[model samples]
Every structure is written in structure tokens, then in C-alpha cells.
Target: MITHIFNSSIVSGPEMLVIPALKKLGEAVSIIFLTETRLPTESARPIEYAMKFGYDVYSVPVNGRWDKTAFLELRNVLDKISPRIIHAHDVKASLYLQQAKRVRPGFKGAIVSTHHGASYRKGKIRLYEEIYVRFVLPSFDKVLCVCELDRKSVIHRGVPEGKVSIHLNGTDRPRVLPEDRNASAATIRKSWKEKMPELPDTDAAVFLGAVARLSPEKRHDRMLKVVASFKKREESGHCKKTVLLCFGEGPEEQKLRQLARTLQLEDRVFFMGYSNTISDEMAGFDALLCLSDGEGIPINLLEAGWAATPVISTRVGGIPDLINSNEAGFLVEKKASDESIAEQMWNMLQNTKQLTSVGQAYQKRVMEFFSHDAWLKKLNEVYATLPGKI
Candidate 1:
């Protein structure tokens, strides 16, 4: 049995990658997902999806405090299950498991951790992450990183090179019928048009968009500045008609909206809040614009490519591994200036034929490298090598 522990049941990139891989592992494999946050809808999509594929599901009431009682409860459950392997999905969960093992040390299973992103990049969180790596990381039998870039980052911060492994995140290529895609596109376009009627119906009305939680690291402010600069160029007759669509919501939504208004981009930009069907929405866009400060291979980029939409992204995190400038997609430098983003946008807009060709190449690359089956095969290999596994 393989048991996975996480901090929340809310939908995110890592959950999407892990759940689908677990489902493909077949019914003989016992899987358990433990999360502290309860699903608001009661219809937890991850749990429901896992159950549909015949995996045992469990939800324990875990308080916010990661105290001795929490550790004891987790250890007690581990004792009952006697799982062959325990895999913690994030830093907090990994630390909790490490603490639980210290109190109850007889657990014979191998402990593994998959570090999803760079926690150190977020101000004082770096200090906490340094401490965790120094103290808690060595306790795990193995540490896994979601991408090669992350593996290097962890190793640089004190994880032994030999103890770390790289496993790229994966996605299932959803069966997108032509009619379905067209319908989805129409729905998305209609909603955006309703919100911003000034948008033209001409092909010149290029949709440049992104889908990510509105956070400081996502650099939505930087993206908005880029759009503002583009709008300036358009007004000056140096660029053509374009629109920017931002999907997903977080604490920074209001701040980003304010920034848009300050830049006089109120008419040219639209914030579509959080939408569950982001993949369907990507179809309406001419290209995806991702300007994150960091990431571990965003699944949305892969999804967009799978849908044959080209990407314009910052050269950060594991993105470089998935995209090649002007080949698979365009790569802008990190924290790029407004002028740089504007130039790239203009270049892409001017070369429609080139953009389409690159997007097609990107679609083929995703099929070859990021498929659900590829993820399952790699994970099964890791599972087979774990200590105490059957």
C-alpha cells in the first residue's frame, strides 16, 4: 500500500499530477490521501476521482496546530495501516511525518518527500526552509523533486545529491472533441466580450492570458505592466488591437485590478476570477502569457500546448525544460521590463504562421513527454524500489 499525505483537498497543480498517476496504478494498489482542510462542497473532486478508480479514501480531522497530538494521531493511523511506503507531498507534511517518526520510531516503511516548489524565494520562509532541510530532510529515506531544476535547488541547499530524485509532473491529455472545444471557445469568448464590449471581433483582437493564483510570486503585477505597455504601443499605432485575460483569484486580485486601473488598462484587461475549467478556457486565447517568479513545471502550460495554443513565458523554474524559444514557445527573461514583453508580443502577433507552426510542434512534444501513461510508468518504477514494498 502507498499512502500519500497533503495539507489540503483544494485543487492545485500537484494534486492534479499525483491523483491521476495514482488512479492509473490500478485497483490492487491501496492508496490513502490525508488532508487537513475539509472540502467545502463535500464533493471533493480529488477524493471522488480516486474512489472512481477503486482506491480507499480517508479524511482525518487535523487541527491547524502541528503539535504532539497531531503527530500522535498521524502515527497511530500509520501504525494501523502498516503502509509499505509513506510519501509526503509538500514541506509541511514532510516535517509533520518526520516529527511523528521521532515520537514513534518503529514504523518500518520508507519515507519519501516530493518538494513541489522553492519555498525559500518567499522572504522569511527561506529561513524556515533552510532549517527544515538541515534538520528534517535527512530523516527521509529519499527526497524527490518535481523537476531537474528543483533537484538542483534542493541539493544546493543541503540535501545530499545521492538521496534526491527527479520526477517531472504529468497530465492526462483529456479527450477534447472539436465540437466540445468550439463550444468551450464560444462560451469563453462570449463571457469576455460581454465584460469588455470594446473588444473587436477581428482576428486582430488577440487574447493574451494566464491562469494562476494571484500571488506575489506569480508576478501578475508585472504581467499587467506588460499589457499596459502593449496598450500604449497600440495607441501609438506601433501595435494592433489586443486584449489581456487573467483567470484565477487570490489575495492579490484587488491589488492587480488597482494596478490595471492605474495604468489605464481597465478597458483592455479582464479578470475572470477563479474558474475550475481553465483548460477549456485556454482555447479562446491566441497564446498563454505566464510571468511567474518561480514554478515546478506548471501543468497549465502543458495543457495549453496540448490544446495547440502557443505560450509566452518567463525563463524561470522548470519552464526552460519544457519550452525552447521560437521552437516550442517564446521565453522571456525573468522580471522582464514592459518594453521587452511588448516587443515579444508584437513579434508573435506579426508572425501568425510561425506561431501556429511552433504551437503544433509543442502539441507533439507534450504527447511524447507529458502524457498520463508516462507519469504512471515512472512512478511505478519508484514504487517498486521503495523499502518494504511487495
Candidate 2:
């Protein structure tokens, strides 16, 4: 059986992508949560969900960064489980697994680590990553990358080319069907209006959405600038009033709100914070926007595509891997000026028919390539090719 190691305190794309796979795997797998730096309460949802799948879930505390206590705890769990393979996700978990091997030399399980995304850091943190990549990572039997770009990045970072493999992210199509979009959208919009009285109740109101954390990398301020530019065009009576609804909460909330106020977009920009109904609410949006300075095949864009919602996103990281070749959506430079974003929005406003056609094509691509079944098949192939015989 495979023992997966990861930090489950946050509900990010990696966690969402992993849970469905583990659920389907049943008793074939188990998971260990490394909560050295986070509260056990934060991991309650993921743990409860995994338990429902009949997978054994274990939680261990690692009190500090580079803590020896974390290593001993992991080694103890490995000894009890005696797993044939230890699959770790993210940097901290991967490092801890390596330490477990040192602490318990008798454990002969093969080590596998998934490099979900490149580290975005500076100063001491960046130096630490450079050292880890050059020395610690090459020891793993296999290093899985979420996209081709990441695989190449790993090879460049001193991991042997033979040790790295690409395992692109995937998602299950939501239970909500395309035929039921009208009713679902109507219901979602009604609920949203009740919660946000400032939102227009009419169907004509253009609803653009960005579903990501309010962080610097997400560039929500740029999204606000785009809205501010769009509002300027509206003031000239050239377009209808539009509202940009931002979902997800993070450190930049107050700053974004203040920027919106400064731009006189208090009425045009609405912050919806976090919502569990993101997939169900996709039908309510005319388009989705992702202005992040970087990305790793964002699950939001994938969900939007599967929901047949047209997306406008910056070409960065694995984003170009999804949108550049497809005729289904628009791509802009990461440093694209707000004026440029406004121009694209203006053009999209004049030709709404493209939205439906593009959205359909996007959904087709997702169904063909990024479906859960395809991802599982690919994952099985990766597992079969591992160095150690299972």
C-alpha cells in the first residue's frame, strides 16, 4: 500500500486534487498529515472526508521548521505502517520523509515526491530551496512534477533527468450538468443578490469572477484596475454597468477594498470572500478572470472550463500550457497593462457570441485531457514505472 504524506491544514488545489484520488483508492492507500506548524483543527475537514473513504489517516505534530521531533514522529509512523511506497506532496512533507529514511534505515519503501510548483521566495528562504534542490532532492527515487514546465524546472535545478516525471493536475467534472445551467445560474444569482443587496437583480448585469486567495501573487489589485478602466468606459455611455466579484480571502483584502474605494469602484467591485459552492456558481458568471503573476494549472480555471465558463487569464507558469494553443479563451501577458485588459473586456462585451463558442471548446478540451479518469490512468502508469518493484 502507498502511504501519502502531506500538510492538510489549507484547502488548496493540491489537497482538492488529492482527496478524490485517495477516496477512490479505498484501502489501497493511507495518509499521514504533518501538522507541526498548524493546528489539528485546521485539518478536520480533510481528515473526516478521508475517513469516510475507509483510508487510515494519521496526524503527527512537527513543532518547528527543521525540527528533529518531526523526523522521529514520521519514522515511528513509517515503522508501524510498513508501506511499500511513501508518496509525499509539497516541500516540507518531502523533506520530512527523507529524514524518516535516515532515522529508520530498516524501512525499505521507495520514496516519491511531487514538486507541485516552483518556490516563490527570496533571501534566506530562496537559499534554503536552492540547497534542497541541489542536494536533498536528487536522493528521491522519483520526483513528480504537475506540468511539463515544472518537470523541466526540476531537471534544471540539479535533479537527474531520469528521476523526474510529469504528472499534470486534473479534476472531476462537477455533478451540475450543462443542460441545467439556466436554473442553476438563476438560483445562484438570486442567492447572491440576497447576500449582496448592492448587486443588480437584472439578467443584463455582466458578472465577471476571480476565484483565488487575496494575495500579492494573485494580483487582485490589477483586477481592480481592470474594473476601474471598464467603469471609465461605462461612464462614457459605451457599455453597461459591470461588476467583478472576487472570491477567496487572504492578507490583501483590506488593501484591495481601499484601492477599490480610491478608484470609486465601491459599487462596481464586490468581494464575496470564500464560498464552497464555487462549481455550482460557475453558471452564474459570464466569464472568469485570473490575473495572477504566476500559476500552476489553477484548478479554478479547470473548473471554469469544465463548467463551460469562458476564462481570461494571464500567460504564466502552466497557464500557457492550458490556454495558449486553445481557441476557447483569451490569454494576456502577466505584466499586461490594465488598459490592455480593458480593451479585451470591451471587445468581449461587443461580441458576446464568442463567449458561448469559446466556453464550449474549453469544456471539450477539459473533458478530453484533464478528466479524473485520464489523470488516474496517468498516475497508474507513473506508479508502474517506479524504480522499486511493487
Candidate 3:
């Protein structure tokens, strides 16, 4: 058996990929290896969801990072399943995997980790991240990064070069894009309204998009300020009707909303919080905005790319690799200011005529490279070799 472990993350970026990746794995190997998901206690909903996908799901009753008892509890589960490969998605699980390995010296199962994002955090969280990267991650049999930036970060910090690999998240299968994308923009707009009632009944000519956990790294403040400046600079037309709707939530929500009000953009900017159906919401956006200070490959960009939505994002983490060429999407420097990003947003609006073609081209890139088949193939190879391998 192969086992995948995670914290209580649900309906979010990397966690969302688990089921589909597993499903693809099943198909690829003719269901040769059985797979299971091990989650912490009180993660009933996540366990239930995984069970629906036919993964043997277990909840080990972990109380938090301080819970030492979970290590032995998890070891018991490991003893029962004897998973050939135990892949961890967070710091705590990796620690448990190490403990389980140390105690069972006879165990030959591999321990692997996926460093999902290089997010910017502070204080206790930052300290934890430091420990996770500097200490725990290096011990894993294999460490898969979602982008090259993360792989380089770990290597520079002393993770052996051979242990790291870059693996982009797989996107859902592409759909046949409408030939006249301009005419079909409203179709996406309509889906947005149906999924989210907070949106106005009428669709706007421009829908500026932002989807990420509201945090300093995500720089949602940049998104709001850009919308404010974009509207202030444009005399009329789409600017008058443009709406910058942000999805995802965090401790920074109140701060971002207050910043919007202070910038006199409260009416133009709206926060939609977290959405389980974010994939459905991407198409509604005319242009997706990403200006995070740190990142791996963001789940938002992949979803937007899958939907064929144009993006105005900063070159960070694995983004430059994904948005490698101008034809795929628009990119700004990591240090781009609100004014600079605002200009990009305005330029995109001005050329609204080309939005559909540009978005379609971007979607093509996502399909060609980030498809599930590719992700599954990469995963199987890693799993097969990771036993006493990297």
C-alpha cells in the first residue's frame, strides 16, 4: 500500500489535487497498489471525502503540532498497513514518518514530501516553516517541489540536490473553448453569478480577479490598490464598470477590506472568501491578478489557465516557467508597484478585444504541459524509485 498524509487542509490548492491524482494513479497502474489517506483527528469531513474516492481513510486523533502521542498512533497505522511509500504533505506528518522509520529499523518503506508553496509567513509560523525546511524536509526519501524556486530554495538551504524535483500541479482536462471567446465571456460571467450571489445581477465589461489566501505574501493590497489606480486613471468605459473580486480568506481579510475603503475602492473591490468551487469561478474573470511576494506554482493561476482566463501576475516561484512566453499570459516583475500593475490591468482592459484569444492561448499551454496524465506518470515514477531512492 502507498499512503498519503495531510493536515486538515481542505478545499484548498494542493489538497484539492489529491483525489484526482490518486484517481489517475489508479488508472495508470491498473490499480496494482492500494492507496490511503491519513489525516489528523477532527478531520472527519476530509476523511469522508477521500473515502468517497475509494482511498482507505484514517484519522489518527492528532491534537496539534505538540501532540507526541500521534506519532505512536500513526506508527500503529503504519504497522497495520505497511505502506511501501508514506508521503507526507506537512511538517508534522513528516516528523511522524521519521519517527515511525526510526523505531521500525526493519521497515523499508520510503518517506516522501511535497513542498507545495514557498509562502511568506511570520513569527511562530515562520519559525515552524524554517524548521520544516531546514530540518525535517531533508530527511525525506524524496522531496517534490511544485516549482523550481522551491527546489532551489531547499537545495541552497542544504537539502541534497538529488532528493529534490520540480513537479507542477496537474490541471483538470481542458474543455473546447468557444471560437468567439469575446461572445462567450458572458458565459463565464453567468457561471460566476450563479455560483456566487454576491456579484451583481448584471455582468461587467471587466472583471478583475484575485484568488489567494489573504496574506502579506499574496499582496492582495496590491490588487486593490491597482484597481483603484486603474479606475482613477481611466476616465470612463470599462473602468466605470470594472469590479475587482477577490477569492480566498485569511487573517488579512479585515485589513484588506479596510484598505480598500481607505483607498476609496470599497465599492469596486469585493472579497468572496474561500470557495470549494473555485475552478468554476475562474472563467467568469476577464483577467486574473497575482502579485504574491513568495509562491510555488499558485493553484489560482493553473485554474485560470485551465479556464482560459488571462492573467496579470508577478514572476515568482514557478510562475515564470508557466508563463514563460508573452503569448501565454502577461507577467510583471516581482517588485512591480501598484501603479505598474495597475497599468497592466488597464492595458488588458483596453485590449479587451484580444482577451479571448490570449486566454485561449494560455489555456493551450496548461493543457499541453500540466495535464493529469503527465502528473500521474511523474508520480508513479517517483513512487517506484523512492524506496531507498530519491
Candidate 4:
């Protein structure tokens, strides 16, 4: 069995790949929940979902980041399942998989990990990642990267180029959108005004949505500036009002709100905080925005493409794969300044027919090329070529 290791808390992009993998791979896969707490409470979403698939789900708790003893405990669990592959989704699990080999010398399973993407995490998290990139990652027989940029990043750090493989992220298309597009959008707009009383009338407003954690890497402030620029155009009677609804919460919430206030976009920008209905609500907006400084084949963009929601995103990471070549949607050209990208967002709203055509092309690309079956086939191929043989 291929035992997948997920050490995640919230259900985000990783689930976009993992949940379907569990369902598709079925009995061929099991799961090892490596948790920092006693009950693996941090990973409740994945654990509960994996159990529904009837796979063997093992929850092993490491006392803390410094716990080498955790690997000894893992050996007890490994002895029972004896999975030939231990595939980790994060740096911490990948590091411990390396340590598990040191503690249990007889173990011969192949070690594999998925490098999601690079991000600007600081403090102890950053330190651990530095070690993980430089040391622990080299020990893995295979390192699956979500994008070419990530493959280049790891190989440049010392991992053999042969060991790294690029697997662009994919998604299952959301079941067909509600039949009445106008009614669905009206419903979404009505629901938003009811929940967020502070929001201005959105019926005629060009609604733009951003779905991401309010983290520094997401660069929400850039989105706020776009709205501020739109407000300036509106004041000069040059454009319609644009409202930005930011979903997901993080440590940077207050900071972003302060910047919004500073830019005088209080009425134009609305913080939706955290919402589970991001996929459903996103269909109402004119377009979705992804302003991250770094990314992989981000699941949100994939969902946007499938939902037929045109996206205006920074040209970073694997986004060009989705937008360019096909001319599927808007792209803020490389190394463009904050002012330039703000203009990109501005230009996206200038034409309505272009939005529908671009969104349809993006939808076509996602449906034809980025399917669950295609992703799993690549994953299975990666598993087949691992250096360790059972």
C-alpha cells in the first residue's frame, strides 16, 4: 500500500489533490497522520475524510519538533502496515520520514514527498524549512514538485536533478454551475449584503473575489491597491465601482484592514474572513484574483478555471501554464510593479465580452487537461519509478 502522510490542519489546496487520490487509489493507499498533538486534532479534516474511504489511518503524535522519539513510535505502526511507500505532503513529515529510517535500520520503504511551493514563512518555521530543504529533502528517493519553479528551487539546493519530478496541480471540475447564471449571481450578492451589512450595494458593482489566507505571501494589500485605483477612476467618472471580497483569515488581517483604510478603500473592499462556500460564491464575481508572491499550480486558480470564472493573477510559479499559450485569461506580466498589476486589474473590467470568452477558454483548459485521472496517472507513474523496490 502507498501510505500518504498529511500533517495539515485546514483543508486547503492539498485536499484538492489528496482527497481524490484517496478515492481514486482506494485500497492501494493508506494514510499515516503525523500530528504534533496527542489525538491528531490538527489534521481532523483529512483524517476524518480518509477514514470514510476505509483506508488504514494511523495517527502518530510527535511530542514536538525536536522529538526523535516520535520515529521510534512510528516503527511500531509501520511494522503493522508495512507500506512500501511513505509519501509525505509537507516538510515536517518528510523530515521525520528520514529520521524513521535512521531509527529503524531494517526498514526499506521508499521515501517520497511533495514540495507544494515556496512561501515567505519567517521565524522558527523558516529555520526548520531551511534544514528541511538543505538536509532532509536530499534523503528522499523522490521529490514531487507542483511546478517547474519548485523543481529548480530544490535541485539548486543540492537534491539531484534526477530525483525531482514536476507534477502540475489539477482539480475535479465542480459539478456544473447553477443553471440560471443571473439568479445565482443575484443570490450570491443578496447573501453577501445580508451577512456583511457594511458592504455597499453590489448589484451593479463589478464584484471581484480573492480566496486565500490573509497571509503576507498572498499579498492582499496589492489587491486593496487595485480597488483603490478603481475608486480613483470611479471618482473621475471613468469607471464603475469595484468591490473586493477577501475570503480566509490569517495573522495579517488587521494589517490589511489598516492598509485598506489608509488607501481610503473601506467601502470598496470587504473582508469575508473565512468562508467554506468559496467555490460556490466565486461564480458570482466578474473575476477572481490571485496575487501571491509565490505559488505552485494553486488549487484556487484551478477551481476558478473550472468554474468558468475568469482570473487575473500575477505571472508567477506555474500560473503561466494555465493562462498563457491558450490566452485563457489575464496575466500581470513578469516583475511588473504594483502600479502595473493594478492596471491589469483595471483593464480586465473594461470589457465584459472578453471576460466570458476568456473564462470559457480557461474552463476548457482545466476540463480537458487538468483532470483527476490525469493527475493520478502521473502520481502512479512517479510511484512506479521510485528507486526502492519491494
- Best candidate according to lDDT: 2
1 or 3, which is superior by lDDT?
1
Q: Compared with the true structure, what per-residue lDDT tens digits does model 3 show for residues 282-337?
A: 77777888888877777678878877888888887788878888888888887866
lDDT of 4 by residue, 152-220 (tens): 888898989999998878777564353555566777788988999877665768889999989988889
TM-score on alpha carbons, each prediction: 0.89, 0.93, 0.88, 0.91
Indicate the TM-score of model 3.
0.88
Relative to the unseen true structure, what is the C-alpha lDDT of residue 308 in candidate 4, on a scale of 0 to 100? 80
- lDDT by residue for model 2 (109-189), tens: 888888777635456756766666777789898888877777787799889999888777788767446677667667888
Residues 1-390, model 1: lDDT tens digits: 778876555567887777757766753444444555444443265566567766666555555546667788778777777777888877677888888777755776888888887532676666666766777787788887777788887888788988888877778656444346556556678776776676655355778888888888898888788777777777888556677888887889999999989988887778887676776567677789888878778889888877777888888888887885568988988866768877877787679788777777787777788877777777777767775542
Rate residue 71 of model 2 by lDDT: 90
* Count of clashes, each model: 0, 1, 0, 0
List the candidates ranked by lDDT, beginning with the highest.
Answer: 2, 4, 1, 3
What does the lDDT come to for candidate 4?
0.78
Residue pairs with colliding backbones in model 3 are: none
Residue 118 lDDT in candidate 3: 56
Q: lDDT values of the candidates?
A: 0.74, 0.80, 0.72, 0.78
Worst 10 residues of 4 by lDDT: 173-182
Residue 367, candidate 4: alpha-carbon lDDT = 80
Among all candidates shown, the one with the greatest TM-score:
2
Model 3 lDDT at residue 260: 86
For candidate 1, report its TM-score.
0.89
